[model samples]
Target chain A: MDSGTESASADAWDGEIETEIGHDEYDPYGTLTLIGIYFVIIALLWVFMYFVEFLGEGPTVM
Target chain B: MEIHRYETIWFAASLLLIVGFIGTITYGAVGVGVEMVDDSGGTVDPDNLGSHERFGDTGVHKVNESHYEVNMIAVHPSFIPSEIEIPAGSTVTFYMTASDVTHGFKLVDSNLNTMIIPGQVSEITAEFDEPGEYGFVCHEYCGSLHHEMAGNLSVVPEDEWGGVDS
Candidate 1:
């Protein structure tokens, strides 16, 4: 029964799907843009925290 | 196996982020001259604290013109020298230990924080640039009245600073 269904689906779907481009050709520009923005935000926050928040709150231990 | 271009880029970016974090910490330590608490002060028997030289007489003492040493003890619910006074623009080294249980010493709104262990001494050096009063509290919960374990650090102006007792 499993072999029958597998064969039936294989025959039905054989020419139904078409690959226009390879996976390697895909460029995730949106992901790169989003990550770049996130990186900038993190860097800015780190600077604000280290310099403004930490160093600003002085009388610090050496 | 083939990897995507974005995957390689992301890997490189991740490496950059890690390296950047290490660089920042290194800069803070080297450039900013931030020191960390360590075991340089050595160990002591908490039970025999009364015989110990420094912890026995726990208070602030002037080392020289620009340096001072504060020997402190943290017991159950209080610091031995509850009130501390120092001159402004002086480097103060706090040498502390615990008698009974473990406790924490945290100078509120400052970077001065360390653990007080029974058999070990915790030492931290701090520099106060201005004359002001800073409150400190034991952040680690040790006993029932842990919240009551608080103290004050007063940095007095240079003109009004008193010399150390002999």
Candidate 2:
């Protein structure tokens, strides 16, 4: 283990490169999934609030 | 600039969401008949409310069948005729004005809400569908006792409704 004796370099790193994904190929499936879930939740809440809560509570100004 | 496919989809989705929101609001305004409070209630001299025709005698006025009118004044920490009783299935128009400063009137559990401004009458009309007890509060911060500035609205059955006190 040549700890500090070896100068820090890209080649000196212990990790091995597996596969590289380019910007075009890198599809953020996790982020897209999360955002989709959030959109669904927000849409559901909006429908419930506007239709069920507000519209249902009548005696509104006509 | 080149955009990612997911980013483009998200952008389009966002635009659709915005349009959907506007569409919902339009539907509420046009189809559902939800109206915003406007200056249609006409203006009034806050100082001379005492001698004014309607405000001179503030209370509920029966306007023949299925219609009623309420003349109310909002003072520092109380509404004149704080407890208002009306019949169910009747349309009531409220004409309100503030003598001192600006105050807010928001009826709990109903869509009747407006700001009472000095020298200007805040008028709003609402229908009483069911018989129930509803509370109204001054939402605006007026004075030290603003928290206690509240009132009650009583919607009684048609048969139980006693005509306005002469």
List chain A TM-scores, every candidate, in order.
0.64, 0.64
Compute the lDDT of residue A45 as modeled in candidate 1.
91
Model 2, residue B34: displacement in angstroms?
0.6
Q: Model 1, B67: alpha-carbon shift in Å? A: 0.7
Kindly state the fnat score of candidate 2.
0.74
Residue-level lDDT tens digits of model 2 in A1-62: 48546656544877877888776798889999999999988888988888888877867777
Please write out the lDDT profile of model 1 over residues B1-166, one tens digit for every residue.
8889889988998898889888888988899988788888899999999999988888888888899999999997999898888889999999999999999999988888899999899989988889999999999999999999999988899999875633
Best by lDDT: 2
Q: Can you tell me the DockQ of model 2?
A: 0.58
Give TM-scores of the second chain, every candidate. Answer: 0.94, 0.96
Q: Write the per-residue lDDT of candidate 2 for residues B1-166, one digit (tens) a residue.
A: 7788999999998998889889888999999989999988788888889999889999999888999999999998999979999999999999999888999999988777799999888888888989999999999999999999999999999999988845
Worst 10 residues of 1 chain A by lDDT: A12-21
